[model samples]
Target: MPQWDIAVPTRPGRLPGTTMAGFSDRANTFVDVEVIPHPGVTVVFDLGDLPLVIDDGNGQERRGPVVAGLAPNRVRGQGQPGSFACLQVRMSPVVAHAVLGAASEVSGAVLDLDDLWGRDALRTQERLRAATSWEDRFTVAEAALARRHDAGRAVDPEVAFSWARMVDSRGQLRIDRLAAEVGWSRKRLWSRFRSQIGVTPKRAAQLIRFDHAAHLLAAGHTPAAVAADSGYADQSHLHRDVTTFTGSTPAQVARAPFLAVDDVAWPARR
Candidate 1:
């Protein structure tokens, strides 16, 4: 897929991972695409009055401006309609926990923004819609995120440290070693990490690794090579992970309409 194949491509240049630009529902016109799980949390602020849907196979398909804390390998939001417009922020789990005031138990789940922030969600949407220009809208979104970040409690230091290490290693590190380095027993680390970050350390690592592999596939690499480079024990092991996380084979994910626009809409630091 070409870099800007969507109906409305991301603006020129890029924003930090914590930041994302708004686009009209005209931005993408793709259809019947399932959004696969990624490592970060996605907080979408819907400016348009149209509805949004999230399907995770639990009989719950949410609609409209939602704050989702996705767990490893879960799918959400089948296809967004063209009438929605808003800023969609993709953030590290640390920043996500603070701004969304999310609990780990809600991971792999999608909740309407109203459910999380109550009237603030409605108020913020109204404020964004009232803005006269994109700059003003972005400013309002940033300010709201800053307010929440400052007000919400942070995750445990050890949990943060382990998560950071896992990211740094591209999810190649051993969970036991990570626990040992943080001076916590395996059980303690598992409990705290799951409670705070939504997914267990092992699962989190697998998700991170799959993300790496998926991008490689999108970049035109063969699955065997991607699997090896992504630290899979073998090619079939790699296939299982890709299938588990995406419900698609490597080839299908590579051709996914959703991923065809990611490098532009959500460029990763790696």
Candidate 2:
């Protein structure tokens, strides 16, 4: 993988469910990067001379600050011919629901930040661009998220508890059992979780499981071993999930740049 300047938060954010990374491609060379699916909401603030371009692999593209909802499939960054700097934020869907307002708007979609925050998006870019360093930029971004989260409507506690359980078990627990534990009927839990988290509970579980398996693959584990460890029925099941989520085989995904930089950019996960 090609090296880019990556910056992490100097300290944990005030918010519990958010992680920050700063990235800059200062080479002024042509660049293209594939973006794999992940189980959270992604917000990117552009502070470059030219805007960052995101291609959805279907002839559609968006530039400038953008938000991608859970499990956005087959997306990539096509860097313009210039240096680019941006602060990228990953939010747990529980927090995303409050921070981004209507989380369903971003679920499985890529949208302009302006659509969500309007004038505030531009103001945020200016603030981040004026910051002296990556650490400062992370501070600005976190403050903005904290403000929105404080004012926005929150998801039900039952739904939040369900998501927490899924993450705790690496998505191996049964959803029906989760509902029982959360003190909600399976029907109510499913409805509330889908409306707030953007994806159905089962889909969220699959995404979390797929993320774990992908990282294991990137760590040099074989497909058979990754499948067994990640709770798939078998190697073939893992292969299908990998192909479905990333449009790539397990072998190819193991070498993906998207997964390759997770450790450098988000060390806390390691």
Candidate 3:
């Protein structure tokens, strides 16, 4: 199997954050566990017909469409890690709107995989088998997305940068401050943000906070300090967010050996 390297691509358009791509070589063990420690959303590309099973704490197993925008704390189960080679496109909520069309508002922690993939998802996977390079794979995926009924509008660079700053701040900053910095009113900011990014400012803030905390926890930080430093009211607040978004405690996550990937780390409080 090929070693996986997480690559953060330059922000595109108004998209401010980076895109992380993880690809495994043919001989490696299959990847079974995928713990999403970020609050934004994902657009996945399956490069092979290998079955991709997702169990988000739900009893039934699902396999289908590429997921669009899933809120924080969503857990997905992939059957045996080595079974497939995949590409995951990670983006902040603002960047998500560029591909998902409208700013999304659904609040469920786990989205149904069937709702996103449909039958066409299988066809896409089949076509990906012929792809030779990452760029080719992305091209195939983009072409498939273009055929979707609701692929959403592409985001501009300015909006993406604003969203990045907000997410990177972890909800510590106020919307008015953000608006002022961007030269827009609170109302105008909210309106444009909702239309383009989906979710309200408050919800987006929550996701950002969760993501910031996750970054810290993954890096080997203690939960107590992570909470205090990440601006949570206390350790309990951090625990609640972790439980709500990741379905696990800080201790549980910290002890998990498979999650030791490089991008997965606990961020030290600044």
Among these predictions, the greatest lDDT belongs to 2
Question: Residues 137-209, candidate 2, lDDT per residue (tens digit)?
Answer: 9888998889889998999999898888898888899998998998888899988999999999999999999
Residue 253 in model 1: lDDT: 85
Q: Rank the candidates by TM-score, best first.
A: 2, 1, 3
Report the number of the highest-TM-score candidate: 2
Better of 2 and 3 by TM-score: 2
Task: Report, for every candidate in turn, its global Cα lDDT versus the true structure.
Answer: 0.73, 0.87, 0.59
Residue 252, candidate 1: Cα error in Å is 0.5
lDDT of 3 at 24: 54
Worst 10 residues of 1 by lDDT: 1-10
Error of 1 at 146 (Å): 1.3
Q: Is candidate 1 or candidate 3 better by TM-score?
A: 1
- TM-score for each of the candidates: 0.86, 0.96, 0.71
Name model 1 segments beyond 4 Å from true.
1-17, 25-32, 72-84
Clashes of each: 3, 0, 30
